[model samples]
Target: MSTSTSSTTPLLSLRGINKSFGAVHVLKGVDLDVWPGKVTALVGDNGAGKSTLIKGIAGIYSFDSGSYSFEGQQVEVTNPKQANALGIEVVYQDLALCDNLDVVQNLYLGREATSGVILDETTMERKATETLKGLSVRTLKSVRMKVSSLSGGQRQTVAIARAVLWNSKLVILDEPTAALGVAQTEQVLQLVRRLADAGLAVILISHNMNDVIRVADNVAALYLGQMAAQVPSESLSHGQIVELITAGRSGDLGLKAPDKEVVA
Candidate 1:
């Protein structure tokens, strides 16, 4: 793991964030901080509100109550366009790349440049090449390779490259290495670390403990709709994080222990 210094002020911050759908509360008083130039791993078990929280951040769902701040200013993000306007981009688990398009086409799917009613292919290809090179990507043999011919890791790289092409300040990756092989997983993890090192705030959501410990500077564990703990990765061991995810409390690091019921 490379040691990269984080900014003193968080690029994104949430306080007492709560969300609900009808009567079911999905997120409760969750607090999180994401600093620039560092990776914060969002880890939890199944149905631990990880998806809800990330959706709220991505503006796919609105929080019922809480303070949402970015770059030291309070803001309201209730839609995807608003989130994009604020320089927040999310690369969802599905990747959403087109199998029929090549790398350049996929990278500029919706936001292609044009000049006088004609597409600027040269500009698009040049920008795509620059973006991939800026990220130090070297696995792809050619920028014109079709998506159907690319491997899982290469597809992930294209999705990530698309996210950062718009000068985004923060990037949220959802289960990026879920079905990748060992070597591919390592490649994706290194790409994630590079995003942060390039001065972009990153929120990595994953269920894998080893991946969390390997590249995350901090770990934020969610347990049953509540934030169990958000601490430095080096401060907690693998067992402690597992306990927090499973039990919502690990010694004194998480929620306070429930009071014992009297036997009267």
Candidate 2:
């Protein structure tokens, strides 16, 4: 696969992020960044606001306050299309595919290639084939096979191929390996790392500590809408990360509260 050298800047950044629903706050002053060629894992509990933060980034939900900047410029992303235009793509688990449609069809579903009113079958097929081949994803021979005929892992591959087709700069993947077997989980993890190596920043949210430890360059934990810690993967041990996830704090994690005088 072809690639460019590092450009020396973060592809995306979120600053002082906050989100609230009615009287409850979900994300409290969250700060995060996605550097090109790195996988940044966002870990948290069920209600730690990880999903909410992704929605705000994907434009599914508007933020109550804070900023999102891309390539050093702050812009408003009010809808999915706006986010798409900015080359920010989010791939969730469901593997959203049409069971009846073929791989080429799913790859170019809403935005199919065409010559006037006629579908450009030849062009679309060739491009889809090239994309899969480029990513070293060649588990299937026939692109015309329906989704129902493909295995779970193959279906996930199609979904990700579509994202890469869009030239996405920042891709957010939510529990990509949650439903697959051990082998399939490894398949998706390899794909995730390949995407980052191709220069697209990746944000992976998963409960599997092993997966995070295997692929993530940095880990950020969200505990009850607050950032418990954000540091390199080597800084924390396996048990330490798990402790922060379950109890919101871990003395062994080497994360000490900042010094502040409580009262005079």
The candidate that wins on TM-score is 1
Q: How would you encode candidate 2's per-residue C-alpha lDDT over 1-264 as one tens digit per residue? A: 114355467788888999999999999988887788888899988999999999999999998889899999998987999989999888887878899999999999898999999999999999999888888887888888888898888888888888888888888988888878998888888898898888888899999999999998888888888777777787877888888887777894524556798896
Give the alpha-carbon lDDT of every model: 0.94, 0.86
Query: lDDT tens string, model 1, 129-235?
Result: 99999999999988999999999999999999999999999999999999999999999999999999999999999889999999999999999999999999999
**Alpha carbon lDDT of residue 41, candidate 1?**
96
Candidate 2 total steric clashes: 0
Compute each candidate's TM-score over C-alphas.
0.98, 0.92
Q: Which stretches of candidate 1 lie over 4 Å from their true place?
A: none
Clashes by residue pair, model 1: none
Candidate 2 has its poorest 10 consecutive residues by lDDT at 1-10
- RMSD vs true structure, all candidates: 0.8, 3.0
